[model samples]
Target: MIDNPKIKTIENLLLNKRVRLVQPKNGYRVAIDSVLLAAAVPARTGDKVVDLGCGACAVCACIAKRVNGVELIGVERDPIMADMARQNMSANGFTGRIETNDLTNLPCTWETGQIDHVVANPPYMPANRAYLSPNTKRLTSCVEICASLADWIIVAQRCLRNRGTITLINRADRLNEILSTLNRGFGSIVVFPLFPKAGRDASRVLVQAVRSSRAPMRITSGLLLHEANGHYTSKAEAILRGAPINL
Candidate 1:
């Protein structure tokens, strides 16, 4: 882990406090979307996974802790966030590699059709439509300053082998764009919506697809996070606490 005395941070835990991460205090903090995205990945032993835009390595650490013998590589453009991602990996005792590079312009070392799985929780808000935060980190985390949804899909497909999986979480309103992009190199898509309440409209959705597959798309019943009293349901609690997400 590289030392950065000038960067102010706060420690947070994930996977029911099993993984520790240090993130910029006033910047984009780790969100549940990342954890949920990690859980959506069906990694087996010895699988090679790459996470795009891996802020603070939260998703990497979460998957590593839950899936044994999985090798991970994270791509992040921001130097400070990339440093924090590397530190978080070391702090969590993870063996993944963190590369400080934009996903659209990855290094030559990242070869095509070699990775087993690729996961990402990219920025959901489009720059033209959403309010961009003054804070650079927050703005970048929420808006796509460097890459578009199609760019992320293209890179993930370039790195993943045939039949390899790509999992991601994004705003429900953008599911159409997500599906369209995934169709370019992926198939057999399964979408799982995350509802704030039983009858509420879904605000977020987790989508998983297989590279170059031919199966039909399917949608699950989806996950309702809260009860009427604004408390987490048992299913939500289990998933948030590290239990594997069932598609």
Candidate 2:
């Protein structure tokens, strides 16, 4: 439990209440992107999965709820957020540990080529290009601060085993950057776009690549998140309800 009186928080239900998350009230809160990213990970029973920058462990909770018997680990930079993640995972009856360390400089405890899968919903905006927020937590969560996108990918590559996969969700505009960084250490890339509605451009993309694979990149048809009336599509709603999505 967070004992800081100055820090305000709110409780939210994720994956149809399978995951109960307590997050800071004012800072960056967990959103659907976390759920979507969790759904995209192809983790199986007995596999060890690591989530980089796992704020509140929403992705970990969601993945645990969806896939049984998978070992879950989270890396979070903020101590407060890392505590919240541990609390959330415990409340959900999930077993996992949250390491409060910057993703750019992971602790030596994390052995190389041990993790079966790596999933991340990294900060979307680059620090140099985007205006930062006044709040430190929100600024660090949304905009790249100590770690850039490439830095996150490098960490993922370092921790993941050969043939292990890394899944990420980011802005569609940054697809080129994501691909360029991923190409250096990963292959079998699949770019899955998330469209806001029919006939509209994708606002976000989910990219999955396998470490040391030689398969060619493929772009998927993608999934539409909402209908014309702004309601969630059935697929998106199912995903929010802890359904799995193949990339």
Candidate 3:
């Protein structure tokens, strides 16, 4: 049994309260990025989806609530966070799996080219570019300590079946680098930008691709998350409230 009573944790609701997750109170809480990452994935019933660097498993639990019949697995490097992930999954009644292993060295049970869909909200900053958080969990979650962007993409490429979908949300400034890494094996790529407001440049982007598809890359008209008045756009609210988005 997890000794969460001794851990600094908080309960947060997502998907309009359809799901609840326990996250570290101060270190690396669930944010809009994880929620948007879960929303960007287009998974159907019976699909097998794996979340890389799953943290407290918020993305997987959110996806499980939204997509019925889909199988979910969360891979997290930190054992404490992984244990918390398991607790959150059970608290939310999610039957999906959680693996406390580094994404670069996933267990053999996750066979190559078997996953139907893969989603990740990888560390947005390069390890050398920013000040590392003193909190270990936050540090690993925000920087490429355990895995690089290329490493995450490589693992996704190896795990996805032919034509399987892989989706990611990352810093918008790194779109070029993210695309270059995805080019190794992913195609039919689509980039969806997330603007902070109606006319602002995107702060984040959601990128989706097929494992072995040959379709041309495209950038869609992106999502404006907020209005000039500081309220969430209706569309953004719908998605945050668990409305399915077709990516």
Candidate 4:
């Protein structure tokens, strides 16, 4: 249990109980998108991977479980979430550091071009366009406040090494915006959509790009998350159970 008097938290299982996650009880609980985002990252052993806006380190913990010996770092803007992320990493027997910093103003100590891969599940809604939540934490988690989607891409580009990969999961409607922002700095782009069910529209998309590469973009036959009866598809189940998926 979290010892903080201000924040009420609960322990939950992720990755078929392979990862134990501690998160706030009311605000922005860890979701399946976090697991899918973690699965999309193609990090290998010895790769230095950084997660931007890592609320409670869910992605970091999942990645740690999936890939052993990789260096993990997380940057979270909220202090409470950052503390929980550190605790979660420790509880999972993972070694990593959480930096409480705004994505727009990352610490100068983080050298440019040092990270092998950068992954982000950034806020899906634009601050001006979406309905704002009354709960501060939830609002920040769901809607962009201090940074825009472009800012996240810029930070990813800044941190990633040449030819390194950047992976992101966001609203499917934002594919155009995502691609436009990544156009000059990244290439070899892959857009993978996540359909809620067979013949249904995709609610989310996973986009991966390599910095400074010129390969053309490709869109895969996307994965369906559920059957018509609402059960998870076998492929989706395998991914949620800690299987690594190449984007």
Alpha-carbon lDDT of model 4: 0.92
Clashes of 3: 0
Which pairs of residues clash in candidate 2, taking residues 3 or more apart in a chain or in different chains?
none
Residue-by-residue lDDT tens digits, candidate 3, 54-157 = 88898998898888888988888888888898998888888888888898887544658889999999999998897988988788888888778988988888
* Residue 167 C-alpha lDDT in model 3: 94
lDDT of each: 0.89, 0.91, 0.87, 0.92
**Candidate 4 residues 1-247, lDDT tens each?**
6555669889899999989998999979988999999999999899999999999899999999999999999999999899999999998999988899998888655659999999999999998789899999999999999899999999999999999999999999999999999998899999999999988999999999999999999999978999999999999999999998777
Give the runs in model 1 whose Cα sits over 4 Å from its true position. Answer: 1-3, 107-109
lDDT of 2 by residue, 37-126 (tens): 999999999999999999889899989999999999999988888888888888789999899998867665575999999999989999
Best by lDDT: 4
Best by TM-score: 4
Candidate 3 local accuracy as lDDT? 0.87
Q: Which stretches of candidate 3 lie over 4 Å from their true place?
A: 1-6, 107-109
Q: Pick out the ten consecutive residues of candidate 4 with the lowest summed lDDT.
A: 1-10
| True-structure RMSD for candidate 4 | 1.0
